[model samples]
Target: MTSDTAATAATPAAAKSPRALARARRRHSAVRFWRAYRTHKAGLIGLGTLVVIALAALFAPLLVGADAQSVTDAPGEAMRAPTGEFPLGTDQFGRDLLALLVWGARISLTVGLLAAFLSVAIGTVVGITAGHFRGWYATVIMRVTDWFLVMPTLVLAIALASVMDRSLWTIVVAIGVTTWPTTARLVRAQTLAVESRPYIERAQALGGGHGHIMTRHVLPNVMPLVLAQTTLVISSAILTEATLAFLGLGDPTVVSWGGLLQDAREAGAVSAGDWWYLAPPGIAIAVVALAFTLCGRAVESVLNPRLGVTR
Candidate 1:
């Protein structure tokens, strides 16, 4: 009995607790994901670009003082050509264009990330619910989703922004609520595919409730799709915010890429032949959008190998 007890005690902790095993699986999955992600050159480039841009935005205060935005504390003469004193030159307000660009990145990226998160959260919930349930409930949810999907997202966002207060959060909400329909549709399709799997059926047969089935079985499977979609959504959100700002709906108190363009237009940069004022913001927007697109495509390709054939 003593020997048997000793042998039993020597056994390796019953193959680790469920929590430890889950953590190990997660670590393994992360390794695999990184291995696949790094192989895509475009994705790596995009990620590096974003990292640099994000770091700059995060450290904007240290790079340039807040006085850079102050008209009274202008750093250089207005509309001066690029030189050693001001690489990007000064805007009509005599604020440093370089400083504006740096600060603008902070606002643009914040709006993009927050708006995308809100959009994804709403879409994921609505989609999973609609896909999991049946009968009139599912029909109603899908009809609502279809209605939003059919309407022009930009128009809806414009209308919402028009009616609401002009602030950063207002823009975030306007973009988020209007943009969710696409994500909802994508997630619903993915959810339906996941629900059709044998494991889901087994889960249901084993007395798993709706919450259990959806959260445990369905959500994990669809998360990769959500992640990829989120990156794409962020690009769209940034573009939308820029559009609204350019249309004179942005908060006047803040500096954003879109606001810079608006200021240039109002300041007659075009008539004055000031390309520096127009080019920097435009190029920044395009580059950031392209970076997000590349990253999204890479993630999508990694998750669905069939799509990577062309790449």
Candidate 2:
């Protein structure tokens, strides 16, 4: 009975050892990644900017009351320039520009993140499938990807948005479906390279099924490219969302950076010389896009030192 109890305890500890090792390895990799990431000043700055923006968006309600968003209860005059009473001034609707910006960040960032994730998920799966398989299967997938690649992504997104019910999710889906081809192309190339490695053949020799080989070997090898592409995709997603919103396809009920720009245009902020109304959202969009680009470049450099060296 004592021996059986000891064996049972040992079995659980042995089972836990793999998980504990995996956790330790992940921590070590994260530390290494951070250490390398610290060397890129521009990347660090961009990352800091994103972190600040994310925190502000997350805590927007705490920072500004909901009344700030209420046009009927607006506390300031319409199109007022930045003043002590209202730091960013008021919008055309007499709503506080500062508050609008804070809330807009939440929508913009959420759409960007979710849309990018959807795009990458679809791309990764398609890329893996196309690269892992051969014959007609690979040909069909590649042809479809090529078709999307040749087509104007913005036009596709616009068409999709035009037909859908105007909502946040509609915008996300439009951007996600239209933008995945680029990532698919990228990931397919990486998968092809990974599958060509000797270990993939060894896995095949060991009787690894297609699913096991793809998930365990091909996916892991291609993940670095996927990670790098994700940052770039996010930037594109945000830009697409803004474009759709500017064209009056965005959710009318929600405040977003692009919606603010559209509102500014409708109110004739440019004609009236209300730079305050026009500048904040435009600047925010540009700054966030640039920040994501900077971060993507940094991640690419970290993952592929050869690119860094060439640069």
Candidate 3:
């Protein structure tokens, strides 16, 4: 073939080479991850439960229609026991227990996911910085992480929540800030491991800048661990928000699992034997938390083969 003919032929092959190979590898890895996750019974159950809860939260208004927003205790409905029309019974305020719980799922899940995202974001930045730099910055970052580690998370969250305005965002911020240290430590460990690898050394030798290397090389390698940690963090964040709300620091206007518990407590449900009002929200919290925990553990097992946890 002539020079121009050969060059034209090579262009098509080269155009599909690296990008195609990279995409294939990504697809293969995703398939492998899914295969592993699917075999995990607890993980599947957790994922299913979460999906159901998420669907419920998304369609809560539709589920209960206008009654979801209506005050239930207005006339004859106040503190009524579970019956055909009102499945889960009525709260002291006569709100349908089922409706409240459904709506509460939206608030609870929103706070959980968003707060966890915030925690993960902060943790990833700090961890990546500390792991890549390995100097004074590293020292400062790890020391701060350790300090947060030493403090009681719940107590610190309470103190932080107390200082902030009692709102959903305040609850989210309080939970997120207090919860990031664990994630930071986890990410820092993974980053250190990735930073020391041969590929990373090669990237450094090629004069790749810190930002580029950290984002491209280190971040991708540590993402599996970060993802597993994020699942666990979501569960923790939910519980923490609930705790803060139960302690009377939660936003009063917003309905949430924690708020439900708070209302139940304040209504003397414990003394009145109102199992209908209290059990649903508490059970919802436990089930959702358990779901996340199971899925997180499965992901951790999949990512870290050394654990050798059987599906």
Model 3 accuracy (lDDT, Cα)? 0.89
lDDT of 1 by residue, 75-100 (tens): 78888888887899989978889999
| Candidate 2 lDDT score relative to the true structure | 0.91
Worst 10 residues of 1 by lDDT: 302-311
For residue 129, model 3's alpha carbon misses the true position, in angstroms, by 0.7
Evaluation by TM-score, superior candidate among 1 and 2 = 1
Please, what are the lDDT tens digits per residue for candidate 3 over residues 1-311?
A: 69999999989778887889899899999999999889889899999999999999999878866457455333336778999878999888777888889999999999999999999989988898899998998998899999999999999989989998999999888988888988888889989988888988898899999999999998998888889999999999999989988999999988999999999999999999999988999999999999999999999998997887666
- The parts of candidate 3 lying over 4 Å away from their true place are 1-13, 17-22, 72-76
Worst 10 residues of 2 by lDDT: 302-311
Q: Model 3, 300: alpha-carbon shift in Å?
A: 1.1
The per-residue C-alpha lDDT of model 2 at residue 206 equals: 92
Per-residue lDDT of 1-311 in model 2, one digit per residue for the tens? 99999999888658877779789888999999989988989899889999999999999989887666777898878888999878888998788899999999999999999999999999999999998886799999989999999999999999999999999999999999988988888888888889999998998999999999899999988898999999999999999999899999999999999999999999999899899998999999999999998899999999998896322
Model 1 TM-score? 0.94
For residue 208, give model 1's deviation from the true position in Å.
1.0
